[model samples]
Target: MARMATHMITGAGSGIGAAVARRLHERGDELVLLARDAGRAKELAGAFPGARTLVGDLANPDRLSWAFSHQPLPDRIDSLVHSAGVVDLGPVGELTTRAWRGQLEVNLIAPAELTRLFLPQLRTARGHVVFVNSGAGLNAHAEWSAYAASKHGLKALADSLRAEEHGNGVRVTSVYPGRTASPMQAKVHSQEGKEYDASRWIDPESVATAILASIDLPRDAEVNDLTVRPGH
Candidate 1:
């Protein structure tokens, strides 16, 4: 029998990450979820029994290496999925440096650091890395300056990693989903002062399907980028 695949995921507490975790858990795969604290770690452990949790605050990317040195990392990881992100909307003229730093830390730098830390295990397993970027990664709107910049940087990271890791048998994919119905979306709507309507957007599960498809493809082929838009 083929060995069960293991996936390490961030942002599995809600949204697309939760959907992906549920699907993988149901399929009898091993999961390692990243949490910001012991309490969040406990919550993830409870949510997905038998899955492991690692505590490392994404807000402090510089400390992840130090944090992981003190924790037990999975011996093998078939995929490392980056689905955690934060967004605050404001015009460039009004946005604070703190706001810019917050989004950059969580959305861009955290994923990059996590990938660097896990590259050894990932290369050993010939694993895949999936970045759950946003449509803003492709286009920056008025108030989305900071968030978009981070995601745009994420795209460059994925692209560069793919080029560098291809010979190592490590696949890199970026999934750009447009306005998914997630807590992040709700928060974005709140910031925009718009009424929240979950039904109008793509479902988290739909995006999860795209992510899993990229991960599950045969070793002979790889998906470089995937874009999911609301069907309605």
Candidate 2:
């Protein structure tokens, strides 16, 4: 039997991250889940025996440092799936400094730091780095300036990593998923004062399945970017 590879996923407590965790677990992959909410993370771990859970808020610099430093490692981690993110909706004129800063910290800076921490292992394993970006990462939509800016930053970060790490055999993939049916989307819908329409959004499970397919690609092939949107 082939050795089961380990993957670390941030934001595994809910939404797309949670869905990916479940899918990986079902497929018998070793998992390390990092979620800010200790209680929720622990609860999720109960369903996946042998899976590891780390509690750290992605926005907290101290926690970010602690989470990476404290974790035990194998010679290499097969992949690091960056699924944690925050969404803020507003026109550029209405965007607050705090909101803008918070979004950038979690969406951009945290992932970069985590990637840096895992770079050596990733290089050793020739592993893949998957970023769960937003449709906003591709273009700015009305009333989503802050969120779009942060995701745009994330897209650039992924692009740069792919170029810089190509020689080391590391593959970087950015998944731009549009309006997935998730708690974050529900919150955005509430903010817009519109009826939450689950039917109009892509399901998190479907995105998780696609992510799995990306990872399963033959070593000779690389999927640099994947954009998933609602069919309707």
Candidate 3:
């Protein structure tokens, strides 16, 4: 039998994570879906035969470590997609330490820890690491201090990792996708008159397609940073 490509995807419960999981599943890749919610993880696993699920809050290092240690380790991880993130929008003065830390934990720290833990497997597979970052990382906006800071940190982390792994054959691609149609956005724009047309936002499937394209590129070709936005 042919060997299946192993993939670990964070935030696989919904949004771009789920879309990417589906895309890989269609290609016969074995998936490990990690999320905070067990029910959602099980639901996604049910949709894709042989796709395993890991339920844990990535913000907690103990939880993340325990899950991976107990679960079956993949022979090699062909792709590591960091789509998990949290957005807490508020004026700088109103942003509490707890809230800011929470955003950083999920958006930046967790992914970094995961990358550190799985670096060996990725190196063995000559795999690609994909960071689903945001345009906010490049451009700051009012009332988005925490979110912007976390994304900026993530972008820096990804860039630095790419440079460090230049000769190791592990490629890192930071994708800055603007305004996706996800529950996160709905929560962000829930206030009156700030309603966003989720239908008009970028499709998660399209982002998934782009991710797959990057991964499928020849080893000699690398797309370090890809920016995508809705065409509206």
What is the alpha-carbon lDDT for the whole of candidate 3?
Answer: 0.87
Query: Against the hidden reference, what TM-scores do the models get?
Result: 0.99, 0.95, 0.94
Candidate 1: give its CA RMSD in angstroms. 0.6
Candidate 2 accuracy as TM-score: 0.95
Find the 10 residues in a row with the least total lDDT in model 2: 66-75
Candidate 2 lDDT by residue in tens digits, 45-76: 89678898776688874467767566665567
* Superposition TM-score, candidate 1 onto the true structure: 0.99
- Per-residue lDDT tens digits for candidate 1, residues 150-223, read 99999999999999999999999999999999999999999999999999999999999999999999999999
State which candidate, 2 or 3, has the greater lDDT. Answer: 2
Give per-model CA RMSD.
0.6, 1.5, 1.6
Which of the two candidates, 1 or 2, achieves a greater TM-score against the reference? 1
Tell me the deviation in Å of residue 169 in model 1.
0.1
Ranking by lDDT: 1, 2, 3
In model 3, which runs have C-alpha deviations exceeding 4 angstroms?
Answer: 191-193
Q: State the lDDT of candidate 3 residue by residue for 72-164, as single tens digits.
A: 777688899999888888889888999899999999999998899899999999999999999998998898889899999999999999999
The 10 consecutive residues of candidate 1 with the worst lDDT sum are 68-77
